[model samples]
Target: MLAYIGKRLMQSVITLLVIITIVFLLLRLLPEEGYLGAAAEKMTPEQQEVYLTNLGLRDPILVQLGNFYSNLAQGDLGKSITYRTDVPVVEIIADKILYSLFFGLGAVVLALLIGVPLGILMAQMKGRWLDRLGTGYIVFVVAVPAMVYYLLIQVYVTDFFRLPMLFDEDRPISWILPLISLALGPIASYAMWMRRYMVDELNKDYIQLARAKGVRERTLMFRHVMRNAFIPMAQYLPATILFTITGSIYIESLYSIPGMGGLLVDAIQRQDNAVVQGLVLIFSSLGIIGLFLGDIVMSLVDPRIKLGRGESVR
Candidate 1:
């Protein structure tokens, strides 16, 4: 297990480095004006060249790459070049991450609480009205474009409930719409997958044998069916939770939530290369970490699964 973990960690590091290098090189291909901001308009070619040189933009690509890595090793993510000019990228992200974290956490909690039970109920009541109702909801959520529902919720729901249309930190009630919007997709996803897994478990021979042995339906459902069904789901839980906590870009932007998601969008629109680079690096790192943790979690949840080669148990 330790060896497997070590191997994964090394792979993650290599992947991250490759992603960062690719993004850095690509950003360099953008026009130099992104690095100078509005001030570039006033500067003569000579002055601009001088400015770019001072910023080390004129350095050889190899040298710049070396410098980037050196600074990265020391935790310096550089400064925002256009969006909130001169501010450290880390500082900008730190100021914005809390909002994303708060809403993201709320959304995940809401999704789990509602989605899991809905799935279980649907599974227990298969071929009944309740099952059909849950299935309909899942279908609607999955089929509809997210933006349409998000806008409807913002417009109609807010109007009906007399809630604020946009996010307002001072008005706690305003947080509701955005949180709900963020959770909708996840809720549908969890419900559909949970129901499918439970139903699959119910059809297996083990379940038939247990039923033949006179195990109570409820006991068999929860202890045997759900337990085994959840093993495969465990592999994705960490990744799902981690990604959810990173915030939804469309939801955050629609609600004007001032989160990491919106920040990335704003940086891209404004051509803030530094901020974009920093956010991309952070996001990529999180994705890698999430996958790494997911593997460990799956191994821990099911003893039959082994991380090391040639070590599977029947």
Candidate 2:
């Protein structure tokens, strides 16, 4: 297990390095001769060179990449170019991560709260009204893109109900609607997968044995069935978290929330290479961390499946 974990950690490091390299290369490839495309038209060549140099855009791409790696090795993420201050990149991300978390975490929790029970209900009530209702709900949500629902609720539906707008509220729970919309796809997916898994588990001889032994239906489902059946889905949580973060782009934009996803859009609009690169690195790191977390969690859940790096249980 220890060896497996060590191997996975090395792989994570390698993956992160590759991600940074790709993003650095992309920024270098952007068509700009030292901020030449900026909105400022009065800049002299020397001034432009200084500004770009300061942003490390003037260095050879390879040299700049090496420097970036060096700084990162020293735990220094470069400052924002557009923001034009000494604020640490990580600090900036930390400050705004809460909003994304508010939505992302809420969505995940909601999906689990709704999805797992639905799965169990569908399995136990297979071929009955309950199963049909569960299937219908999943199908309807899956058929409609989340963006459509977000708009529908924010526009026509909410207006009709005369409910306070999410963004208009003082509390972040006002974000609940958008968060639900963001989570809808994953919730739909979970229902489909978990229901099938639960059905399979229920059909197993072990389940029949338990039922024959007079176990309560609820205990049989939750204590034995759901726990074992949901293991595969547990492996999926990290990726789902990443998807939620990326999906936040549209949701945040629609809601006018000032989170990283919306900030990414602003960076692109301004051709702010540093902002774009910084965000890419930040999000990529988050993704890598999520992957690591998933692996560790899975290893913990099933010790037979040890980490790649052979590290002891975290």
* TM-score of every candidate relative to the true structure: 0.96, 0.86
Backbone clashes under 3 angstroms, per model: 0, 19
- CA lDDT, candidate 1, residue 1: 80
Per-model CA lDDT versus the true structure: 0.88, 0.76
Write one digit per residue (lDDT tens) for candidate 2, span 248-299.
Answer: 8888888877788887887676566666777887788778877777777776
- Expressed as tens digits, the lDDT of each residue in 1-314 for candidate 1 is 88888988999999999999999999889888877778988999999999899889999999999999999899999998789978999999999988988988889889989988888888889999998988999999989999999999999999999999989889999999999999998888888888899999999998999899999998998898888878877777778877887758888899999999999999988888778888998888888888888888888888878887784621
Residue 91 accuracy (lDDT) in model 1: 99
- Candidate 2 worst ten-residue window by lDDT: 305-314
**Which lDDT value does model 2 have at 144?**
77
RMSD of model 1 against the true structure: 1.7
Most lDDT-accurate candidate: 1
